[model samples]
Target: MTLPTITVDLLDSKAKQTQKRQLAKSLTKVLSETLGYPDKEITIIFKST
Candidate 1:
């Protein structure tokens, strides 16, 4: 089965690189644990608006 892509869009927001990475890591972990999906199978896309 194919998992859906997770896209995060920041609208007129400014965030540091480290912050983004940490957010991604936290999100991946939480999502994986809660949804029973492997970390490697999760996809996170960050977009600047």
Candidate 2:
């Protein structure tokens, strides 16, 4: 059994796109692992607003 996908809302008020992407990827990887999901299967959406 699988649960519905989750969403994270993060904003880069001062960070650059590169930095945001890096953080997003790292965060997603850790979250997936913590949530018992494969890191590679993690999905992350980064936004700056």
Candidate 3:
């Protein structure tokens, strides 16, 4: 299924790759509950701008 765009803007800090991955996962969970969608089914794009 096609999902809507997900955009998050924040200041660029000293976040590592693993930490970013975890943040992405957590965001997915939040999205699932907020958007009524499963994390596995949603396509997410994480951008820092």
Candidate 4:
């Protein structure tokens, strides 16, 4: 099966590194649990808008 890549766009241009890490971790955890996918298989990409 192909892995899933989740793209997240942040509205805040000054988002901190700590906040991004936390957001990525939380998104990965929730997505993995809800979608039954492995943590390593889920990809989270953050882009500043």
* TM-score to native of every candidate shown: 0.88, 0.52, 0.61, 0.86
Worst ten in a row by lDDT for model 3: 4-13
Of 1 and 3, the candidate ahead on TM-score is: 1
Note the clash tally of each candidate.
0, 0, 0, 0
Q: Compose the digit string of candidate 4's lDDT tens values, residues 1-49.
A: 8998899888867888998899899999999999999999999999988
Per-residue lDDT of candidate 3, residues 1-49 (tens digit): 5775566555776777788788888888888999898777766665665
Q: Pick the candidate with the highest lDDT.
A: 4
Q: List pairs with backbone clashes in candidate 1.
A: none
lDDT of 1 by residue, 1-49 (tens): 8884689999986899999999999999999989999898999999999
What is the descending TM-score order? 1, 4, 3, 2
Report clash pairs, candidate 2.
none
Q: Indicate the residue-level lDDT of 4 in model 4.
A: 80
Computed on alpha carbons, the lDDT of every model, listed in order, comes to 0.90, 0.66, 0.74, 0.91
lDDT (0-100) at residue 18 of candidate 4?
96
Q: State which candidate, 3 or 4, has the greater TM-score.
A: 4
Which prediction has the highest TM-score against the true structure? 1
